[model samples]
Target: MKLYTEDPERILIYGGSRKDSGEIRGIISGDTLKGSFYYSSYGGGTLKRYPVAMLKRENKWLLGKGVISIYMGIPSYLKTEPIDYSDPKFIFEEVKK
Candidate 1:
C-alpha cells in the first residue's frame, strides 16, 4: 500500500493486487487520519465500503475501530470491530526509499 499527502490535510491511499484494488481518501489532523475506503474485488464480483481511521504512533500506523460493509454478492454482511494495532496484520509501516 501507498499513502500520499495531497496537501496538509488531504491524504490519498491506494493498494492491491492485479485483480483487486482499494483506495481511500482521508483528512489528516495532527497524527490522526479519518477516512473512507472503497474496494473492488476480483472479477468485479464484490464491492466493499468502510470507514477507516489511522493514527501515527512513532514509526507505525494504527487502524481505528470501524464498520465495514461488503456488497455486490449473496449473503453480504457488515462487520464492526476494533483493529489491534500491535498485530502485524493490522499495523502498517512506512515504505523506505
Candidate 2:
C-alpha cells in the first residue's frame, strides 16, 4: 500500500491488485488523524469500506482498531471511539530534494 496527501487533513491510500484504492479524511488532532477511509478491493476482499483512526507514531502511521458505526447510510467510526495505535501500517518518508 502507498500513502500520499494533498492536504494532511485529507490523505489518499492506494494499492492492492487491479485498480483498488482508498481515501482518508478527518481531523488531525495532535499526532493522530481521527477520520474515515473508504475502499473496495477484489484481491484483498469483496468489499471493505469503513472508518479509520490512524495514529502518527514516531516515523510511521499506525492503523488502529475502533468501533465502526453507520451514519446517513454510510459506515463510519463513531466520534466517541478512540482509535488505538496498536496496529501500524507501513508508510514512507521523502528525502529532501
- Each model's lDDT: 0.56, 0.60
- Stretches of model 2 off by over 4 angstroms after superposition: 4-19, 39-49, 79-81, 89-97
Model 1 Cα shift for residue 36 (angstroms): 0.7
Model 2 Cα lDDT, one tens digit per residue, 22-64: 5665789888776666655533555556666767666777777
* Candidate 1 RMSD to the correct structure: 6.5
Model 1 per-residue lDDT tens digits across residues 28-74: 99987767666565535666666677888887777765445555642
Q: All candidates' TM-scores?
A: 0.51, 0.58
Residue pairs with backbone overlap in model 2: none
lDDT of 1 at 85: 45
Q: Summing lDDT over every window of 10 consecutive residues in candidate 1, give the lowest-scoring window.
A: 4-13
Count of clashes in candidate 1: 0
